[model samples]
Target: MSATLRSIAMGDGTAPVDMLAALFEARGWPCSADSAEEISGEIQGSWATYQVRCVWRAEDRVLQLLCLPDIRIAKEKRAPATELLALINEQMWLGHFDIWSDGGMLLYRHGAMLGDDGLLTLSQAQALVEAAIEECDRFYPAFQFVLWSDKSAREALDSALIDAAGEA
Candidate 1:
């Protein structure tokens, strides 16, 4: 199994964000902790380089993973993008995609609630990060279709959801 799948438990004594930093380190993804509560990393996806941030909320005992794809919607495209976000979120199982209202940046967000002991397993962390990336990668083309092409939100979603039968 990969390092990310190892059954390591965090939060025995160390902060959960530290555990995330270690996971990013193991993946060789450059990451840094701005404070004890948060760490950010860069992950390369099929469509773009994603900026991932893991934030630990000690008070709520929650860990949130935010993944931002390298796409920014123009002001005029915001309406269509918002429409697409709602459609995409409806199909999501774990995380949901949103556009940063002020900046028009596309991002995927998911949160995990830690146990009473504040322990988080490596697989949980891996799942959080991987799910965000996967969702962002999967929907990126839809955002592009809405923002850059002439496709409407529904059309873009339909186009993005198409599955390939075989490799070329």
Candidate 2:
């Protein structure tokens, strides 16, 4: 399955987490609730699975939105960063222009960064995240988001919980 990356803006009254899930569900995409205690959620659909994780910096009031396909099929489909960069340079998708990967994670940008173009601001990042999630729902009809807790150990425990949930 193919997935896109983008950002979103958090609004008043609605926390970022709640607003995102509600938006997806409104679009006919099934979404798990905030899962506030944990920072992630696994959204399941008939054909695909999506994992959305919100890494928040409470002291800075910032959040890093991450969404990826649970299945790593696209790893083979992915071109090298140089080739991906060329595609971005040629095709331009509104806010998305930069695409690269670090370790196991793929990263993209929407605005300008430092002196480089396509760096996303905090608000832009949030919007991009929301947009990416929406796009995934549209293109990959059957997708789910797997949520995780903040602490690494907690995330591991949550995974175990999910495994146990499935066994039951």
Candidate 3:
């Protein structure tokens, strides 16, 4: 970690959620802190604009981050979406994609334990947010392929991964 991150994580006494808010502000990203425990922001990715939310659970000493695209899976497409989510999740090292049963909303979810201090280092918080966005952006196109283009889950995932690898 850099000296600034060390100081922010140790000396400033910032809560995990507040740290996220501060990080977003420093990046000049628009965000809102709905409460002491939660912050929501937006980020523009190559595929789409994503909604990012960070929630700090004081009781659990866990910080959760979620990144969601603007797309919604239709009821009939949920099966393929779920399969694509599973296939995509298996390839991810940091976060996993999930579809909400209630709303058919698909998102990438990740959590980090803050340990005894109940604080997140600036670098750690930044990584969590970045990982979420990266995963969502990477798979957004596959999701479109599966849900809208009638591609099989495996085919969609394969195409997305191949495209990503080529770009990288």
Candidate 4:
């Protein structure tokens, strides 16, 4: 067995994986446990689809929840994407945005460390999903600005987060 699998086996007493799967199901998410260490599903948002995944870290009792935008960043867009992600991540309390080096896949990621019992409460799990989606919705337009409109990273981010009307 792989090291990841072995650690999970060590955590069998708390059943962290089972808890994660059940949490997703309870929230009406289409979750897949095809991978013993991860549960993933698509969350339908009014604006776009957020692909959400939860990967369990057994020994540490941490569950990493990731939300990825359906859009792919182009080669020329990677630098701007990285800058925008950095700007967005700075303001986040729960998670941060990341771009994959290989495919330039944009993601918003966070983790919850379960207590000694190593299980998530229904409310806690729901909060994770809610927070991820909320952050994704808030920051996605900035990405679009950089990807489609050729806006500079700062310009895109400014347009996304700034409330011009609030300036007196």
Number of the top TM-score candidate: 1
Error of 1 at 122 (Å): 0.4
82, model 1: CA deviation in Å? 0.9
Tell me the lDDT of model 1 at 149.
Answer: 90
- Model 1 earns a TM-score of 0.90
Q: Which scores greater on TM-score, model 2 or model 4?
A: 4
After TM-score superposition, the amount by which residue 135's alpha carbon in candidate 2 deviates from its true location, in angstroms, is 4.3
Q: Rank the candidate models, highest TM-score first.
A: 1, 3, 4, 2
By summed lDDT, the worst window of 10 consecutive residues in model 3 runs over: 1-10
Model 4, span 19-117: residue lDDT tens: 556655655668788577788888877569889888988789889988987878878888888888787788888889888778878888898888887
Cα-lDDT of candidate 1: 0.83
In candidate 1, what are the lDDT values of residues 16-135, reduced to their tens digit? Answer: 786777778788889999899999989998898899998899889998889988788889888888899999999999978887877888888898889876766667777888888888
**Whole-model Cα lDDT of every candidate shown, in order:** 0.83, 0.40, 0.82, 0.78
Better of 1 and 2 by lDDT: 1
Ranking by lDDT: 1, 3, 4, 2
Model 2 Cα shift for residue 115 (angstroms): 24
| Full-model lDDT, candidate 3 | 0.82
The sequence of per-residue lDDT tens digits that candidate 3 reaches over residues 35-79 is: 999999998888888999888899999888888897788999988
Total clashing pairs for each candidate: 0, 31, 0, 0
Which ten contiguous residues of candidate 2 have the minimum total lDDT? 141-150
lDDT score of residue 49 within candidate 4: 83
Better candidate number, 2 or 3, judged by TM-score = 3
Q: Which stretches of candidate 3 lie over 4 Å from their true place?
A: 1-13, 164-168
Reference-based TM-score of each model = 0.90, 0.38, 0.89, 0.81
